[model samples]
Target: MSKFDDLPEARRRGLEKMEEVYGFDMSDGEGDFFRYTADHLFGDIWQRPGLSDRDRRLLLIGLLAGQGAADVLGIQVPAAHANGELDDDALREIVVFLSHYAGWPNGARLNSIVEETIAKARRS
Candidate 1:
């Protein structure tokens, strides 16, 4: 019924980290969308027909850059790093990649977040 049900505990732990550390607040939803997304989006969907985790990470980084979601980028950049989704160079690549579509300011902001995230992750 939910992807969480089938997900490995490690990945589920990642989900919990995202929710707790990032304040995802899944409880606000009425449907099982949270579980569904966790399972499907992060678990099955990610493992199935969608792009590779690295690509998804790239997509997320780029999308976040486009929206100038510096906060989410700050969080996800480290999470994405923890998951081995992108190396520092690769992460930088995504931020650079975004400059073409999103503009310099958004890319600049995301670059700052990425740098801070990488630094913090290195400490932890």
Candidate 2:
């Protein structure tokens, strides 16, 4: 059976987008949480109802910025791109949103990650 056979349509769409467009091959390259991220974060958890993919991306921006996770923000940035929830202007808007709670310093860090990720995604 296909991994998606019983899954919700949103999750199936998310998995396909990750594989075909974003080109992430899920694996335990970093061990532990990285593997958990690929499997649970994207695979299982995000499939839950109530929150749309757009809201997921927005929450990602908030949680990442709140935690000062600049490095992972690059990874999450591409997720919105893959899911069609983001564009250049939308990314800027996300940083603006984060600035309210996460502060300018956090927003700047998140923006730096977004910029780097945007450039890399455009290139590759």
Kindly report the root-mean-square deviation of model 1 from the true structure over all alpha carbons: 5.7
Off by over 4 Å in 1: 1-31
Poorly placed runs, candidate 2 (over 4 Å): 1-23, 28-43, 121-124
Residues 1-124, model 2: lDDT tens digits? 5465565554554555456434465322356765455456666677679987788778777998998887778777876776678887888788888888898999999888777767877898
Candidate 1: what lDDT? 0.68
Clash-forming residue pairs, model 2: none
**Residue 40 lDDT in candidate 2:** 64
lDDT of candidate 1 over 1-124, digit per residue (tens): 4344455764564464445333444322234766566645554555555566567667777788888888778777877776766778887887788877999999899888778877877888
State in Å the error of residue 3, model 2. Answer: 8.8
Estimated TM-score per prediction?
A: 0.65, 0.66
Best-fitting candidate, measured by TM-score? 2
Q: What is the lDDT of residue 67 in candidate 2?
A: 89
